[model samples]
Target: MGPRFQNDDRVRLYREMYEQHGPIAPVVLPGDVPCWLVLGYRELHRITSDSALFSRDSGLWNQWPNIPADWPLLPMVGKQPSILYTVGERHHRRSALVSDALAAVDPFELRDRSERFADQLIDRLCGRGSADLIADYAKELPALVLAQLYGFSDQAGAELVPGINALVDGGPDALRGRDRVQAAMSGLLTSRREAPAAGVASRMLHHDYSSDFSFQEILEDMMVNFVAGHQPTADWIGNSLRLMLTDDRFAASLSGGRHSVAEAMNEVLWEDTPSQNIAGRWATRDTQLAGRHIAAGDLLMLSFAAANADPQVRPDRTSFTGGNSAFLSFGHGDHRCPYPAQDIAEGIARTGIEVLLDRLPDVELAVSAHALVWRSSPFLRGLASLPVRFTPTPTSAAGVYR
Candidate 1:
């Protein structure tokens, strides 16, 4: 099994494969889908950086046209009418639209919203001695913040997350989750058109930016942003908490004022990146890479998780990698995550988790690290629930939500 396909000890599997098979190893996926898994750090950099040779457009894939309707990997590799599926000038144009919408957002506002939401969420469970941080605190933080970016309230955010969660769950009923997300988005678009607001959703509907993309096209990009932003941001928060609470390095750094929450975030990104592998990129033509023969239209999976953890690179895991650009957490080249989403995601995770640590000073995991359940998603790595226990710490003279 590959990184995304593995439920337990995923990193170990990727490492074992890389050690045994060298950089690029051809492997069969769950449904007997054959593809080459790229596990070398430098090799992955080369493939992702040279996008011209390795196309993101699924239309270029020779096999997809003949693949069965229920191909298990379709949900992972399926192309949408969005930037995620386009390349060249078309990719640039759609990327500009997403970037512009994100640019309009204020990062400071995102930080404030994150802290506020954390306060509210923690306030609910701090009275009790225990809580599930994933479900109760970490999971919804990104969705609620994203909702604000889209000009909606927490009520709308709450309605949208369950469906998105299901879609990413990679189960047989993923379509039901997809349909729910679409319905929620359609309703949001209708609501914004009916009563315009100052968020991204309303702006997409009313702005002159509509001149670039049709209303439907705008919705497609927003769906991408929503799904993309929520999963990783939520995962990063959960992962960051696990690292900070359990890892001695983080504890020492934070206690000694040597590291900020952002440092912990970068460490997590470098170590256990939200998604172990970026989805399959088809070879544009026959080419040789890392001593392996490559055929046209063959699937190439970039193991960002494996690469970042490569011993040749990260020989010293204790060293800080905040300045390291070699870690492809946000990816590289034309397909990199939008700058705004990246910024907002980091801000959300850092600010939210930092707030939790400050408020719940004594919080610790309720179960052993090995006992925590990893979420099953083709595109993300996150825990299903982060159950935690802490003394019932009350807020200052100010109210709990304060």
Candidate 2:
């Protein structure tokens, strides 16, 4: 049986193990499932790449009656089988759809939209002297962008934010929130089917798949995409902003105007990686990894957080700067995350940051940096709250984007 540890202790132990052991370590999960936590850069790459040896299907979790069946919010966003969770030819086809959508969209247009969103947010918070960065800025920005892409009305988009938060946080409250979000999404899916709009949901609805995706399948896809799309981006923005504020060198990099804020943002994604712990995978056959013996049917967890810090892969790894390209926050190989298109999302996120920095270069943290609370979840990583103080920028004469 797996040794029991408090959530806090487990997280601490995981971090310590990474520091002490290099990469792979033994982890005792609930129910005593003997598992190997892959923390090394190369090991993570190997484990995620060998689809034949590892399975993404939640067969083990699905069989557990106590766990919520509707836990994963993937099925409701698109018709594709969440490229991150499937294997073989199906995975290929699903990935192609996501790639094609990103490729079809104009990059400059997306960046402009991001800049406008950032301008509006800064207008609201700048000079206000105090704001909860998570609520006032980070959370809302990504939710709005995703909503716009999905053709949701502002009101509908607003309604879903709390629900998304609950789902990502995961607990008793999360179950309740999931129910609310699922219902809302179900209704929206039905309405869209009746009156399709020219957005992502509409595109998914009209996708010319060889096999027709069922209504439930479409709903599942939406859930995954919506939750994945917003939560992590929100976490990234909040965390990156906090880091930049605290680290003079990183902040200077942004304000110096020499290294474009865009490059700095890429460094953030590569370094911080909001999705700290990816979902568990089951091994199909005994496999050797990092000289450890593996048994078939054992569980394996990938720690992107740990991998991003590995010195072998990210040679210059540091807290503020370094370890950019080596970070595999997004899983590698066939099951890599397909949304927010790194190029597009990074551009959009950076454009927003650039606008904010341009307007409020002196913005600083309202609360002590150490006082900020880190959110706890086995699946995600981010701030629970970020209180910041800054002078508000004057509202642009231009109207907000509809």
Which predicted model would earn the best lDDT? 1
Residue lDDT tens for model 1, 1-402: 344454656666777787888889888666667788888888888887888899897876766766788776776687778778878887787787777777788877888788888888788888898999888877777887888788766777767777877776667777898998888888888888889978887876766556677778878888888888888888999988888777776775344343556777888888778966777688989999988989998888877887887777877755778756668888878898888778888888888887887787778889997777777654577778888998997754334542
Query: How close is every model to the real structure, measured as TM-score?
Result: 0.90, 0.84
Minimum summed lDDT over a 10-residue window in model 2 is located at: 1-10
Off by over 4 Å in 1: 2-8, 171-174, 191-196, 205-209, 252-258, 316-325, 395-402
Best by TM-score: 1
Superposed by TM-score, candidate 1 places the C-alpha of residue 136 at a distance from the truth, in angstroms, of 1.0
- What would the per-residue lDDT of candidate 2 be over residues 1-402, giving only the tens digit for each residue? 112121224434555787776588887554443557888878888888888888776553322433344434333211234445666777676666555544555667777667767777766766567788788778878776676667677678767777877776776688788898889888877887889876666666666651446777767777777777778778777767877777676767445463646455556666556787765676777778777777776667888877776666656545445434646877787777764466555655666666667777767888887687767555666788888776665666544433
Tell me the whole-model lDDT of each prediction, alpha carbons only: 0.78, 0.67
In candidate 2, how many Å is residue 385 off? 2.0
